[model samples]
Target: MLFPLFFMLMFPVECLTDLIEPITGGVCGIMTPEQYSEDLYMEDEILSSVSLSIKESGLNDVSIAPGYGRLLTMLATVSKAGSILEIGALGGYSGVCLARGMKEGGRLISLELKEDNAALARRNLELAGFGRGTEYMVGPALDSLKQLESRGERFDFFLIDADKENYPVYLEYAIRLAKPGAIIAGDNTLLRGRTLNPDKNGPSVLAMRKFNDMIATDERLISTMLPAYDGLALAVVK
Candidate 1:
């Protein structure tokens, strides 16, 4: 859980801290994580501005951190995605990142639980000049995901940042809705190191662990986990 703004940044499978105060961790060649964030994390006035809005609006401050945001953008761009699906839209911080990577006519569909949060994210995305290409489906995320599945809609990229408890379910749906060569990325999968804690057998932790396990073991996808802020799991759907 961490931020360019971290909760439900894909849909985190829980409150994976997208908007928590930036912490210094992770390792680079020479610079410290704090130094890397201060120096390497690209600066985007729009994202910075949106982050401020979410913080002031009393919304979940656990927005995805700028580091993860940049990574999402790069991944989306590298994948040359035409359609991106985001499981959770919190303040549109990650949405903007994902959309920035889309090919010229790419589309982005975001699922959010609360009306207010969705409204806010919609507004922010519009502000980011993604109005025409962005769509929002509000209500329980599972319901919207099911609707998408029923409609036979598929995506080139999938971001799972919602409820940790439902992450496995979400991953199943993602696999079901994915196109060949699609990319599936998840956040807070490390559950702030809880997954590695043998002492923590809590339900959410267990679920997150399962999420990681599925990604790691599923033969349909090739995946890896990055031990940075919280943790990041990235997979390529085969």
Candidate 2:
């Protein structure tokens, strides 16, 4: 039968694992693709709800990847962030993750360029049980940052995932708005690897390159670039 042949062909899976183990230095020992997938999408009920909300709101195109969400959550948790500011609020997926990772009574403020996206994010945040400690502001992120600055608001963490052309400006504003020892993160820093090609690099890539260079050279911060999930740039203020 076809099933018997298929089982026989797949039966010696451990042999493949053993072969790869030495090559990978025992990293993924005997784990199948399915197991790897489970590891990648390590979500509980709230994260699942946030993901479902993003899908239902038709915001999959702008939603953060699961791995990126986990990274944000881990950073928030590690920092014990009391005040988080997010530059983009697409469907509230990342906001929910950050809020969930915050210390008890911590607050998150998200800025969205579109009113509809802001509403969608507010709804999604409420659905994800972040209705209490989150706020969605509809405006240009730079303008919102100015307002927050005028109001003397300082954040413990900042997440920048908005228009790429303004990444450097965002970093400047984030630096101004950050508290001492705050963590700032920027998404999509690699721009699909176009930053390397001078002729091919567009405004976004060039701006991101400038942003990366600034962070790397800044004496006031410690920073690193993560190669995964389209490149994440993280900096800690001194």
Which digits, one per residue and each the tens of the lDDT, describe model 1 over residues 12-44? Answer: 433344234353443222466745785865667
Candidate 2 CA-lDDT value: 0.84
Give the range of the ten consecutive residues with the poorest summed lDDT in model 1: 21-30
Q: Which 10-residue span in candidate 2 carries the lowest summed lDDT? A: 19-28
Q: Please, what is the TM-score per model? A: 0.85, 0.81
If candidate 1 were superposed on the true structure by all CA atoms, what would the RMSD be?
10.8
Query: Per-residue error at 115 for model 1, in Å?
Result: 0.7
- Give the whole-model CA lDDT for all candidates, comma-separated: 0.86, 0.84
How well is each residue in 1-238 modelled by candidate 2, as lDDT tens digits? 7996676576476656555445632333555443465586777787677667767767655666667788889989989999999999887888888887898998999999999888978887888778899988888988898899999999999999999899999999999989999999988887777876678777888899999999888998999998765788999999
lDDT (Cα, 0-100) at 201 in candidate 1:
96
Top-TM-score candidate index: 1
Residue-pair clashes per prediction, in order, are: 28, 0
